[model samples]
Target: MESDEIVRKFYDETVDDEWERLERHRVEFELTKRYLNRYIKPGDKVLDLGGGPGRYSLYLAELGCDVTLADLSEKNIEFALKKANEQGLAIKRLQVDARELSTIEDSQFDYVLCMGPMYHLKSEEDRAKTIRECLKKLKPNGIMFVAFISSYSFVWDYLIRNPELILDSERKSELNKIVDGKDFAGKGFSDNFYISPENVLPFFNQFDLEKLHLLNSESFLYLREPELLRQKPEVINAWLDLAEQVCEREDLLSMAEHIMYIGKKPIKT
Candidate 1:
């Protein structure tokens, strides 16, 4: 199936339940809240770019931040609105694509988040434009948190799980048809872009970078033997703490499944 189709199917089948499950997890939800709260102050205007089903938008609104949830899919917008209404949370939801978000006023948001776009946009120009758009919307020194998939996922999925695609790609890179340029064996879904650490630094360097952090939300601890990790929450927490401590080091961040970058827009001279 095509990448877009895969996303549509995945969201259609799982987004609702996934949102509820992820939201209910106190540890994960609190961690996400802490991350967002770092950039948000009370009454600040915020935008959730590519905000699927308004998870982060709702969270931000609960924290007294005014939030606009922008996404491309009408279904997602409807879902977000329904959830917001049911919860009595006020979030402005818009069906807008990240690559073309000009309808929003310039320098209007204190914080702009583009968490879902970097992994799906295949073209370099489109990806960079999304970043530029985020930068354009932020007030000077406004914080933006963006997420991307890492290159190390390829080794985990392809070499470890499915070797055929990796072996084929080894023979010829073009024939690889690897998903998002990461996992050769990631035939389950289509259209992924796995960015290397080398590419990520320069990509954010295009803006005035403030801080870069790695989040192993779906890798490392989560991917470890579930039973073992769950049996020893303290052990898991200890490992996670250690991971975060060293994640900024060059070798560790490259292996993360998702990286959260905290960047600031430069003030005009």
Candidate 2:
């Protein structure tokens, strides 16, 4: 599946108009909010790359930040525009490829979020370009929030769930192929690269890593028994507290579904 098609399917089947509002109250939303709060402040100029349904962008706008919501899907842009208009909030929407970001001005935003682009980019060069363009758009000392699929999730998803597939050497061997700098599972559009926590630092070193926070966005909650976990509010809160501690530890960071890196652009010469 091409990434665009996958994203279309995602919106069509997995999400609806209420996705934006509902997702904000989820456990992962709380984690993202706490981490992102460190970078964003009132009156900041913010750009949300791949702003699906404009949830985070809307939050930023409400916080008094001037926000630009950019995505590759026209449908998403239209949806965002409709919602923005309804709230009487001023938000700029643009349809853009994450790899080619010429539409946005350089050094113009105080904060840039390259959230979903990295996951769908099947090529390291494309990933690098996405990061570089994000860097170019940031003012000196600007912050960027990036998300990546973590490798450990694949181990659990592929190795644990379907052991028979991995047990067959021929079948498992085929899974290791890397094409155009993307792993076999990452070959298709919807399937993007999953990097280990160890690989992240070197990749970000090409720019500058100001703060790195690994987020177990969907993992902890999804792993638990739904009924029991949902009924006990204290357990969920404790789980989050533990997850936060886990994110800070070197060994456990890779166990996350997605890891976020909050990076900085150097002071311009």
Candidate 3:
């Protein structure tokens, strides 16, 4: 299947429930909120690129940010609009491709939250174009938040959860490709591009953006068995606290299932 079709179908079928089910998803959402609070003020204009179902957009709207959500999936936009109306939150929802935000004027937003596009844009050219477009949409010194699936974490996950894949010749080749920062799309997997921590900065260096921080969205949480990690609320909260403290630790960053790169567009002198 083509990348856009695969992504659209995946979200259309699963956007309603899959994200809320995982412990890691909850951690990612919490960390995202924490970072947004740190950088955004009330009344700021935020562009949430590829924001499925308005998860972050609704939260930002509630916090008084003028939020606009753009996504490729029509079903996602439908769900997002429904949720926004239900919550009595007013937010702009656009069903559009992240790479082609031509309708939005340049330098119009205070912050750009690109949490989903990087995961599926397989080619380096596509990724760079997407990032550049996002930066273009932000005002001078405006912040951009981009997220990626970490290659190391994916490999580690397979080793721990599905070791049989490592033994099978065909599956091993696909796994090796993923470890090499590529992905294979199929019935079980959406088209994705896994990125290594070491390569992330260099990948985005072409743009005139200042690096603010690189964080592991779910650091130590990835190491814990999901069933065990879900047992105690207090323990889980403490673990999340620990994740916040060590999110920027370089040694542990690549081990996270999701990695976030926060950068600011430099103000021209």
lDDT of 2 by residue, 113-161 (tens): 8877877776788889999889888998888989887755555556545
Best by lDDT: 3
TM-score of 3: 0.91
For candidate 3, write residues 1-269 as lDDT tens digits: 67788888888898767446443457777776788889999899999999887888988999999999999888878888898899999999788888888988899999999998988888888889899899889999899999987776557778778878888887676567654664433323577777777788888779999999999887666666465466788887877777788888899876788899999999999
**lDDT for 13 (candidate 3):** 90
* Model 3 stretches with alpha carbons more than 4 Å out: 18-24, 177-188, 225-232
Residue pairs in candidate 3 whose N, alpha carbon or C atoms collide under 3 angstroms: none
TM-score of every prediction relative to native: 0.78, 0.80, 0.91
CA RMSD of all predictions: 4.4, 4.1, 2.4
TM-score, cand. 2: 0.80
Off by over 4 Å in 2: 1-25, 158-189, 208-222, 225-229, 232-235
Q: How many Å off is the CA of 91 in candidate 1?
A: 0.6
